[model samples]
Target: MNPCRPEEPPTVGVEEEYFLVHPGSRAVVPASARVVARASAALGEDVAGEFTEFQVEGRTQPCSGARELRAELCRVRTALADAARAEGLRLCASGTPVIADADADVSGDRSGDSTLTYISDHPRYRAGVLQYRSMLDDFAVCAFHAHVHLPDRETAVLTCNHLRPWLPLLVAMSANSPYHRGRDTGYAGWRAVIRSRFPCLGPPPYAASLAEHERLATAMAATEAMLDPGMPFWDVRPNPHLPTLEVRAMDVLPDVADTVALTLLIRALVATAASRAAAGDPGPRTGAELLRAAYWRAARDGWPGHGADPLTGRVLPYAVQAQKLVGHVRPALRAYGDEDEVTAFLDRLASRGPGAERQRARMAAEGRLSAVVDGLVRETCPDR
Candidate 1:
């Protein structure tokens, strides 16, 4: 996560990604006019559009903690769906849609050069086609992005540094990118690898302060690589325009509730880390060691990395890791009145593991690939 670190109060915001599904066939659709029109109306004034024509992002008003984050996510998702449904469109939170071809490039012109579409313009979309021409050599990709506001850039940097180790866990937590272009790709989070094609992406650079981080950003800027801020494309990143930390790793989830829960968790993490930082306490585990641990797990096992501290070279089983994770974060969640949210999310994770695991189970059992795509959204669709 590229951020500024300093001691201060913590602020929170959320950005959620959605797949615009055609209500007629439950297939992916380029959620352009309808998605934007309805979402702009349905979401509060804070909602913003993402780069993808089919994707839209909703942000929270600066929030206090887990409970507030939950409320913010709930309200935003309800409004987003309300807007999407208004035009016979359904919102899907899955990391990757069932049909890789679920969505259409409504712009009819892929002019943009950034994977993070700044707008749906023929020139810009076409610009995107020409850019990232090297990294996108393999596999198709789609993604959802979320952001959390902080009190200041400096504090945002601190939260980012501390949270780096956990970004993979968050991705593992939000593992929804199981399929690739309508096929059951074996990887749990294939998009994670696919998106790494861009320059200066994947994990973040090491820096102690936002100033140094900016220096790095400045250096990258000199290379003329930033077609869009979204193009920097790290898993846990920040938005320069918005006063928030943007978490870009999660595959869009099927259920808005899961997204909500994940938002709550992120808010809790930021709040807790900020609280610790405010009192001169050490913050979350970050840096090269932690980042290495998380990246390896997310790339290999996805969320099940919860079981072992790959960084410490411990091969603890999944059960042990689960206990460790609960032990570490439960107090924070409980303090935020989010124990229930944590529990519900855990149940879903345990039952299905990651989306990739679930997809594999189905595909292996049925010996049919289409079933995997068809059910990806349905399986993870919002639970109530």
Candidate 2:
């Protein structure tokens, strides 16, 4: 457990992406709102709806670090699972679920939206509809979002600033969107590209300070490009409603354990960045160029690609980048006293096998797209 000190920082929240499957068919089901209505008693006034019908999200009670975050996720996943099961439904956690049929529309049903029958109504959703209507015509996507609390707006801004270059690293580390529409999309995180369909919802520009962040947000809002601060779909972004940094790039992790590992890694990143900034170190030398390289790298090869050097644009296979990033963030990992957690969880991910690689291999052997998706269903949620 991460011992929470009074000065150890304030609040942290997590958002989860879940899908309902049609029982024996194991295909997508439009049962989110139905399950949500069923779980409201258990959710007990604590939850938020994601952009799609298939996605039901929950925000955790704020916390200081990873230990608390894990507990929160377990609680929410359990509740959701129980509620969904009661309705003869099962929940799936993957970037994209395997489909036997294409009738499932992931992008919000505009008709559903027009009637205000959707789950949540943040301005972000409204602007997203206006900006990406073309791409979203009949598409539906699902993902998990993790929002970590910072002590102040400045820390949030600084976290966003320093963490930019490594956004791709985070994305790569969590890539699980290997298969889509019954086919391997070739991209490690097709979901990233899928979600990028929204207008004001891509990566944020390089901002030096809180003032600059405000300026960027103003420009986006004024142009009516994005709905508001809720947009900006950077792999790592600042959350306007709360004093936290939200990571929007990861796919839904396979299991509670893997989700715990990913959560620990993210918390370590934010804590290290925040602590360094508070002490005046300003974090690492990551810049837009290097960051863009990381983004493209993950969008392309996921965990296998080598990280690119910010200075020379040279790629240092993960073998090389691992040394630098681990060395660079070691102090914070040590400071957070999460070295054991990081090592334990990361080793499992490294050895347990990467999802995308497994997906591609499965497709080669199975020679069937449905088989690939079925393999994924087995991978993400196994019936014990």
Clashing pairs in 2: 12-63, 106-140, 107-139, 107-140
lDDT of 2: 0.64
lDDT of 2 at 253: 70
lDDT of 2 at 83: 73
Best by TM-score: 2
- The local lDDT score (0 to 100) that residue 202 gets in candidate 2 is 44
**Candidate 1: regions farther than 4 A off:** 1-11, 23-27, 44-48, 62-75, 82-88, 101-119, 122-130, 134-149, 228-232, 275-296, 305-311, 315-319, 360-384
Residue-level lDDT of model 2, residues 46-69, one tens digit each, is 554566665676656775666787
TM-score on alpha carbons, each prediction: 0.76, 0.84
Sliding window of 10 residues with minimal summed lDDT for model 2: 1-10
Which structure among the candidates has the greatest lDDT?
2
lDDT of 2 at 345: 60
* Model 1 TM: 0.76
Pairing residues by index, what is the TM-score of model 2? 0.84
* Model 2 / residue 31 / CA error / Å: 1.4
